[model samples]
Target: MASKCGLLLFVATIQVLIVAAAVFNGIRSGYTKVPTGQFNSNIDQILLGQNSIERILWDDFQKTPELTAFFVTENPVKTIANGAFQRTPKLERLGLRGCQLTGFPNLVYVHGSLIELHMSNNLITKFTREDVHGFTKLQMLDLSRNPIASFPDMRYILPSLKTFNMQGIGFNCCLPLYQLKHPVLVIDAAPCAYPDHITDRLCLLESRFRKFRWNHRLEIKAGYSSSLGGTACQEGIFGPTCSH
Candidate 1:
């Protein structure tokens, strides 16, 4: 009988998974929990870390133009209105780390598909050149551990910048950081820690706030708030309360 029908089809007697199939019915599909600190995702990235989100208006989120990364780290965010990602035309990474911003918000003159613009540990103090005249395709610009001392004209609006992290920004060691009498060397390498001791990784010049007596004109200066939407940190002192 053809070897007993090939041993009864390998003892199955008919040939198959012995008729006890269950390719994937092990069941465990019921997930829906993402509410603390906020979440509105399906992968296009929008972290919203530690949210108490002060402001980013424009209906917060859901204008996805295939949104491409937009975090609000350690949120207490002070401002960010003007088309807050304005239907994210493929926003290429834009985080506001440890918020309570003081300047340079309005999504950097209308996101030009930013390629990483962290705004490190907020409470920012400066940023000029018409506030980054449209970031001309920015490429990694993390104003490390803010309290910044105004910068812009990065070769005139980041003409495709390639990493400019002002580590713990503190340049005004007596206002010489800029005086343009033909003094062009603001970022041929962009790495700082000038006046007071600063740190946020390597540029650290030994500073535990160096014994807190540094008001060298507010080290990174930005008490200049005539309120055009910037500066905020008194009300239980928001996040990044002058970050370290």
Candidate 2:
């Protein structure tokens, strides 16, 4: 009996070790080659991982000013450093999955050009309306598998956003998605505790807006902004200097 028990234990330990080795090898095989000195000049898109030699190389970015897409996954990018993307003005698509980043990097320079942002499997907690208001042309946003608890009104901010992915984040309140006129595909409906209240508010808001002119309808929250017949003008959705 004792020999049989020992044999079973040894087999389980061997299985665990085999799984761990396989995972390690898989990660190693998935690494994309970082551009070398001469290879950096004309590259428009690059896949990066922890072993990327150019991770901290600023000159590489300067050489590739027209870089449009950047993907960094299955690794931890400790610091993106200020002005890292200052020269990549044409950057449109950015993916930072599994980068261990706590928040977004400073991409103020690329705000106007960025269209798709994928930050899945990071440690992000929140994304206020103001955080994304500047990306007017932004179309797709994937924040799946993050730790975000709540997000502000998406309609008032990302009016042009088409694909919004919030799967794997556990939210407790209903998102005000009615304000978005553009066709948007929302993934993962929020699991709210007060379903009745949320449903009633959405119903009332939608019904109230149906009576008003489309141009006159502004997204609003209670006691948050100046109301035209109890409908407050949505904030932070305007262009620079609130021109829009």
Residue pairs that clash (backbone atoms under 3 angstroms), model 2: none
For model 1 the local lDDT of residue 217 reads 27
User: What's the lDDT for candidate 1?
Assistant: 0.52
- Clashes in candidate 2: how many? 0
Q: Report the Cα lDDT for residue 38, model 2.
A: 37
TM-score of each: 0.27, 0.59
Residue 2, candidate 1: C-alpha displacement in angstroms: 73
Positional deviation of residue 65's Cα in model 2 after best superposition, in angstroms: 1.5
Best by lDDT: 2
The TM-score that candidate 2 achieves is: 0.59
User: What are the lDDT figures for the candidates, one per model?
Assistant: 0.52, 0.57
Model 2: per-residue Cα lDDT over 199-225, one tens digit each: 211212242232112212223332232
